[model samples]
Target: MLKSFDNKALEELNDSNASENERAKKGLKKRSDFGYAVLFLGPSLLLLGVFVFYPMIKTLYMSLFLTNNFGQTTIFVGLKNYTSLLTSASFLASLSSTFIYVIGVMVLTIVLGLALAVFANQKLKGIQFFRTIFSSTMGVSVSVAAIFFLFVFNPTTGLLNQMAGLLHLPQLNWMTDPNLAMITVIVSTVWMNLGFTFLVLFGALQAVPRSLYDAADIEGASKSYQLFKITIPMISPSLFFVGIVTLIGAFKSFGLIDLMTAGGPNNATNLLVYRIYQDAFLNGNYSQASTESIVLTIIIAVMTIIQFKVLEKRVNY
Candidate 1:
């Protein structure tokens, strides 16, 4: 009876394997069938081709030409526009301003977000309330935030100046002053980005194991020591992710600059993205704009690569 049962079980296992092999063979035969894939992916591919690839290719092509106000290409310049932009004082200034804005925003957002997340992660009463408050700005639209800051940063008749007057402090121009304009915009951007960064870091903090902290405590580690040795290492992945995102967002910022400064006060806050916009629309220099666009894209790509190369090794996971 035992022998018969063993043989029967082996036969059943063989039958199951045979059925699976047949099904796999059928699946292999059907692999060439792309009807469903085309049905699903055709629309997305078409959209990408029309909207993304075509524009990108056109921009590259246009960058090699001299375009008129009527969007007509007059001559093939073959990187002359790029050379001119590279040698131009205004373009260089815009590039410098872009770096300042991107770096400042990235640093401030990551530091403040991590600080707030650590604070919120502590066990205390009303912690949830503070977390909600810190994350509230995530819901604010970019236009609305820019408008709100416009009022706040107004040199005269603004809340900041009014408060300064109450304390008899000297009123400083926020938007009009070349020295202060870029700083003002950077601060506003940092604030606008804070909510999302804070939320991400906050979640990352929660996911860190309490056992690690307990172990550190048992080892008589100081809070600061634990923070540097353990907490930061654990959350470094989140920090890196947020840093990359903030870097890109800073590079692409346009709305706040448009609303508040409009690259005013001698082009003090004229970042690369806004410069591109101005060249294309306001000045009707499409070729130059496209050249700057390409440059901007390359700059962003390089920065992203550098960040990944340098920062990825530090991330714990």
Candidate 2:
């Protein structure tokens, strides 16, 4: 009887497996299943091809030629435009400024965002209000923030100098002084980006299981120790996301530099994006501008690759 029962159970399992296989085969025959997918993805692919891919290819092709002041390609200069950019003083200065701006924004935004996220994650009354206030900076557009900072950092009638004067501190140039212009821009960019970073990290922090914290507490781990070991590792994915986004935003910053300094005080704040604008729009050096843009794109791509390679090792899956 036991042998008969075992054979019956095996037969039932085989029947179930056969049914599943039959269903899977029927599903494979359903070509209409992917129709909705293609329908959904078709528009996006078309848009990307038209806008992003086509422009990228055009820019690369345009970079090979020297353009006249009217933005027309006047000569087939080959790689001379790129070589000139490498050797140009203003281009070099802008490249240096770009690195500085990107790094400053990345470091400041991540550090401040993490700190704020940690604080905002606390179980306290009216915490939502604090979170909202902290993330409010994201609402301010780059142009608006630049305009606001323009007044804030004004030497005579500005809030910064006024406050310094009230405090009996010596007034210093903010945007006018070459040394401080990039720093001022960095500050503004960091502030503008902090809100999104904070929001991402805060959400990541909330997703961390409370049981992990409890376990850490039971292990007698200090808050700092727990934070470093558990919190950071767990939220590393979010941190990585914020880092990449901030880096890209910093590299593409145009409005702040345009409004605040206009690459002023002798091109002190002329970041790569602004320099590209200067070349393409202001100087009408379309070929050279395209070259600079390509260089900028390469730099961003290399840096992003480096970030993935270096940071991925430390990131907890």
**Winning candidate number (lDDT):** 1
TM-score of 2: 0.84
Q: How would you encode candidate 2's per-residue C-alpha lDDT over 169-194 as one tens digit per residue? A: 99999877897887898888888988
Q: In angstroms, give how far residue 230 of model 2 lies from its true place.
A: 2.1
Candidate 1 residue-wise lDDT, 7-57, digit = tens? 345556889989878988887552544888899999999999999899888
Error of 1 at 289 (Å): 0.3
**Candidate 1 lDDT (Cα, 0 to 1):** 0.86
RMSD values for the candidates in order, in angstroms, are: 10.5, 10.4
* Model 2 backbone overlap count: 0
